[model samples]
Target: MYAIHSVLAGLLAGSASMSALEVKSEVGRSGEDGIFQSKGIPSPATNDAATSANFKLLSGMADPNGASLDVLHDGRIPRSEDDPRSNFFFAGGSNGGRILVDLGKVIDVSSIATYSWHPGSRAAQKYQVYVADGSAEGFSAELKEDADPTKAGWEKLGEVDTSGEQPGQHAARLSPAKGKSLGKCRWVLFEVRKNPNAGPFNDTFFSEIDIIDAAGPELVRIERPKKVIRQFGSKHGNFRYTLDVSAAPDLEEWCAEHLIPVMDEWYPKIIEMLPVEGITAAESITFTLRNPADLPQNLRGVPAYASGNSVVFNADFMRRQQTGEAIGAGVHEVVHVVQFGGTREKSARQRGRANRPPSWVTEGVADYIRWFLYEPQSKGAEITRRNFDRANYDGSYRITANFFDWVIRNHEKDLMRKLNVATHDGYSDDLWKEWTGKTVQELNDGWKAYHKKKLGL
Candidate 1:
């Protein structure tokens, strides 16, 4: 997408070669964005982003468990990050998915600061903002967007769009008001669109959303990253992937018919991939099928997410899709379950946080297995004529899966499993060299060369 189209692009230009530093999102680093949808601010969004700023305490606002009383009025400006401890929010559905934020009590609101991010093609988000008075409950009741909002119970603001978007291995910032005050109310909603047309992923992420109390703003002194921060995403309890279908009986039926059986079948395979000990997951694993309306807007197009032994699926989304789709998706989610990596592991890595397994690799591991190991017949991970010129091993999903499969065959026999194990237990690209006697860039070079020769370019 960035226009690097020579026949042997990375090889000829050297600029396109993906180095260790070039890899964007790895595990413990991916990223969020908004609101009344849940009782609290979003952090620990399904994607791994966190923090509004890099201060020590209350640094990553909106990160899972990382909210701060001072985030809104602290007066400290937010700069984003790819750290798992970074702050952000997530909304789901298809396009126009949104988050509703309820300020529990009515406070005089003058300005709002909202920030969102994604590391790759998913970064550019188009969104419309709105605010409602305490008298309003939610968008649950339809009101006129064109009429007087106070009389109609809400006021809609102009749309905001992001630029300078690139593969997000790093983070990008989106301004809620762009430094101008938006006179406020008790409730605010951000209706977001990641894509105008359908492709694959389309959830909106919010890294920071604050209803500024600039008049009586709070100040938070800069601090270093600490345990207090990771705790925002710290996990407790055992691994479980339970399926809750109380809302949708049909989804329950489908899960019983497909998801459960396949997950049960793949459990051992994923377990076998993670060779680490002392990393036992929670005993319970749940896969909940939720009503799309009640679920967060971020979960909109997201078919499934694996967190703390639990995986949640967009029930209505799944219900409409085929049973075979759920079965293949089950393999990927279960890998996350087997990953069993958590905040504690992340905290340990923070001491030397340079090289966590990038999100692409972990995600690639999931697709690699789903396509190559589980169902090669599908050719699901094939690199096609259409996408080959721009494809990178870190491009993620099936592309990365195909790359992973190539490295496993040409370099090390156990590359995928070993890489998974290293990432789960705190290892990085150093392991890449350990297995192949080559650095990540070297491996990328070899992989690209293989493709170039195959294409006869």
Candidate 2:
């Protein structure tokens, strides 16, 4: 089993006097088990003032890759760490935005909590909170980029900066200090900011926000659909897998009848096919069938993709191609889950530079495993007379897969394994010659020539 890391910290600092507010934070937990289940800090609230409030983006643009502003108070959390549609973030190249939450009327605001989840820098939180009752002198519903909230009838409650090395589930709770009250307020503004020291895409993936009312009805938590999680393992107990069909329950029967069997047989084989020294493949993998509408617009048409130990499939595509290409596509993405399971930081440091493997090589290996080893009967990578001219070794996907198949059949039998390891340990074109006694270009040319003649093109 993989080791799980969890960290909790109490952060109590702000730009102004925080005598009335206290902050608590925690990070590094999985979504299926840990998120919104905090013990030391307040978990996200479903029946909060924000639930009935109207949210508007007052400043920066929303990232097209992330969910809209409504996601913040939707009373639902992401099912996975990297679920883009369940979180809202500012655009990559811009500064963070402001969110205005109008609670209809002033009530006693008791506490506020924010939740976020991601596997990288975007998991961190950095923002300031402000509240108002709209009766203060010079009160402005919206402030300019250079304007100060404290000068515009807004009470600067406190600031939160949970930036740290760990990347996982993170939550921040702000409540009144001992013997103090946050007082009454009707408008709450979040002045969010991107992490300056982090990468270009440092905008936080805000999953959900909660605003507790001091005197309100009993809390009614949001009810999520019961997850249909099927847990199974290899016969030898060497690997474990989970299949989740909660988002697309309609495909549950099809998955049981077809998808599960293929995964049970092929997942272990793919892991064994690509072995790297001093690196063990991920012992646990998750396969999730997601509604196409829940996916980012860019990924709605993609059959499936893998991230970390998770593989997400487009439910619409799976439904349309279940009896035809769906199983094969699942195999392809499973190959990626194994391919990217290991850490390359040590390898990059030893090589003195980070040499990313080319996309052609990456996609080629996945398709090679899918079309050649898993379902060769489909002949999915075949080069016909019509596409023979366009079939190049570096063409990616099926074309590159066909090239790899030819190389393995003609020159080296274990070429894919060697190439997989080489790419994991910092890839270079020179490694091709060392393994097959020919340059990459030579192999590309020979592959095309053989296919051209075979197709009589």
Candidate 3:
């Protein structure tokens, strides 16, 4: 059995081992500040030498003989005070809070195993593990849900049973097939089902997580010369993307300094706007650079595409686009990644045939973030309220985007937050009533009046 050390010792060991390695992370605060920051643990680039056996040990890597902290019980349910990394309360109240682990420089990970205590009763806690393919866009949950590896882009190894498990300690393991290969993975996630004041908090607490790697095996190698590089924003299982200097001598450093941080800020805003359940951080996600020819004919700005759980962008856009205040066309394509659902169930639901969101609302939200969060002052009010005439609420693209902007400025603290949860077709009058205590017409009339007063028309 693998001998486990204390978390502090593991952190120290991991940090010491990393002294000679470069630690890459985006530096910025999420849109909202809180006690815990969603910072990426430092990860080194993938190479031949960084295999599982060679990587330094972490405190949490092995199983513990006892619980990490004293459990406080209300009746039989136990609650442990939060610790910096493992505590439950550290998770932000947002519905999609996640934990990601960067298998820095490690290769040939045959499998991963984790055990977490079910917080309520075993039956009430449902958990799943996700694996991102290396890109931040594409990922796969447990295998049975996605039997066809080619279709889902990943093979779900297996699963854990929470039934009758204790609330204080739990564990599970993922060991891929003998020949399967692994690389620099971002995490081995433990996701628990959450419900409102199921406040004995119906989730799981992790006591241990383990990684099983081939003692030695061949690795997947990236052989092509670097021509284009793309960076992505990921949350839950979805992605948003951006690209940086491709042929530059210092490509990685350039991305860390300029592109990555900006993508980090934009991430939470997009998640708040649109949410997906059933995905986690540990799974494989892809963010790649593709030719402009890859995009659908209907889109614009050197077109970027997100599918196959990966994002591909027009390299020419990054090579030649003029510098402006906002994230350019590159970031626009990244948003599409988040729109794809993990399974047929989610895809069918998102197709929204019965409750389809208006073209205006869908595209408008995308456009709003392009300017508001990524490029705050690029064109100013040129894209603001003036174009939101009463007749244009149903108008598409920029026109509707302007209208949505108007509603937020005139009513909700920031329409982005309210519009985040807005449904597709049901947006008619009830949405306005629910948001502003006014019907759609009342809201539009009020907005037009507000704009007119501003112009002194």
Pick the lDDT winner. Answer: 2
Q: Residue 454 of candidate 1: its Cα lDDT?
A: 85
List the global CA lDDT of all models.
0.51, 0.79, 0.41
Specify the highest-TM-score model's number.
2
Name the better of 1 and 2 by TM-score.
Answer: 2
Query: What is candidate 3's CA lDDT for residue 309?
Result: 48
Off by over 4 Å in 2: 1-34, 57-68, 76-98, 105-108, 118-127, 136-138, 145-152, 156-168, 176-184, 192-205, 213-252, 261-320, 330-388, 392-457
- Candidates in order, TM-scores: namely 0.46, 0.54, 0.39
* Candidate 3 per-residue C-alpha lDDT over 1-457 given as tens digits, one digit per residue, 9 for 90 to 100: 1112111101011111111121111111111111111222111112222223222111122113223322111001122222212323212242322333445433445545443333343212244444443443234433342144324333223334434333333333333222344333433443333423246434444433444445543433222244555555554335544443443434445455655565555554555566544332122235444334333434335445556445554555544543542244545544544444333323333434565556566666666667555666665334334453434565654555556777777777656545543442134557678778888788767766776777666
Model 1 lDDT tens row, 337-411: 777543333334333344457889889988988999887887888776777888887899988988888898988
Ordered list by lDDT, greatest first:
2, 1, 3
**Candidate 1 Cα RMSD (Å):** 22.0
Q: So what's the TM-score on candidate 1?
A: 0.46
- Residues 313-423 of candidate 2 have per-residue lDDT tens digits of 999899899779999999999888888874443443343227757899989999999999988999998999888878788899999999899889988999878877776
Which portions of model 3 miss their true places by more than 4 Å?
1-257, 276-285, 294-305, 325-328, 341-352, 380-391, 414-418, 424-429
Report the C-alpha displacement of residue 48, candidate 1, in angstroms: 45
